[model samples]
Target: MKFEKESCSVKELVDDLYLAHQLLVPTHLRFSKEAEGDLFIYTDKKRLSQVITNFLTNACKFTNSGYIKLGFKHLRGTDEAAIFVEDSGIGLSEEEQEKVFSRFFKQDEFSQGAGLGLSICQGIVQNLGGRIALSSKLGKGSRFSVVLPVYKGG
Candidate 1:
């Protein structure tokens, strides 16, 4: 896949996504986002959106009744931007976390997917010169983040 990397406003993307996925959020779960100001990133906007979409989708599926949050965090002097999806859901064990990004690995055998969503997300982030990270604990929750270089455009 070809990526048309460009400068995109992180805030705007989050706003659009929040609106677009409103219907997908389960009635028993709470959904929210945290995007402050006009954070910018130099990357393929569509690809980034795809990664976040997968994160949110998985979070909702595993979480029976909890909160899912999408947030963008940029440290004042850091060179990276972190766009993340966090959830209070059925988290992963150390073993599952190690293989979560592998091509066809799924923690839940009955889950309705080919288990490619996270693998694809990893590929997309790598192609965009970023890294995808996950933090989770069994029966607690999880946070998936895509960290990329910040856009320094004037």
Candidate 2:
């Protein structure tokens, strides 16, 4: 995918995501209260949106009914911003977490998808000079965060 970086609003991006997935009602989706105002970041909007979209899609898939939160926080004392998508869905185990981002890796052998979602997310974040992380507990839920350096204008 082609990537063109420029100053973009995180709020708008997150809003788009929330709108797209908002109808999952019993599975309420919202932006974190801590995410306020317009936070600008330099990156490829499409690529970043794709990564966030993937995270939300997965969240919507695994979560039968609960809440999914999308938000970003400017990391203090650091030049990075943390964009996270969290879901109250089936969580992954420690062993599964290790393999979740591996190409063609899926927990359930019969599940849909080529198991390339997280792997692609990793590459996209890395391409944007960022990294993705995960925290999950089996039967509880999962949280995925992508940390990208905040863009400072030249």
TM per model? 0.95, 0.89
lDDT of 2: 0.82
lDDT of each: 0.90, 0.82
Model 1: weakest 10-residue lDDT segment is 33-42
Residues 15-116, candidate 1: write the lDDT tens digits: 888898888999789999988666889899998999899999999999987899988888568888888899999999999999999998988889899999
- Candidate 1 residues lying further than 4 Å off, grouped into runs, are none
Per-residue error for 13 in candidate 1, Å, reads 0.7
The best candidate in terms of lDDT = 1
* Model 2 alpha-carbon drift over 4 Å, by segment: 24-34
Q: Mind giving the per-residue lDDT tens digits that candidate 2 earns over 1-154? A: 7789999888788778677756643425443423766677889999998898888778877877667788888878998788898877889999999999999998777878999999999999999988998999988889899898877777
lDDT of 1: 0.90
RMSD of each: 1.2, 2.2
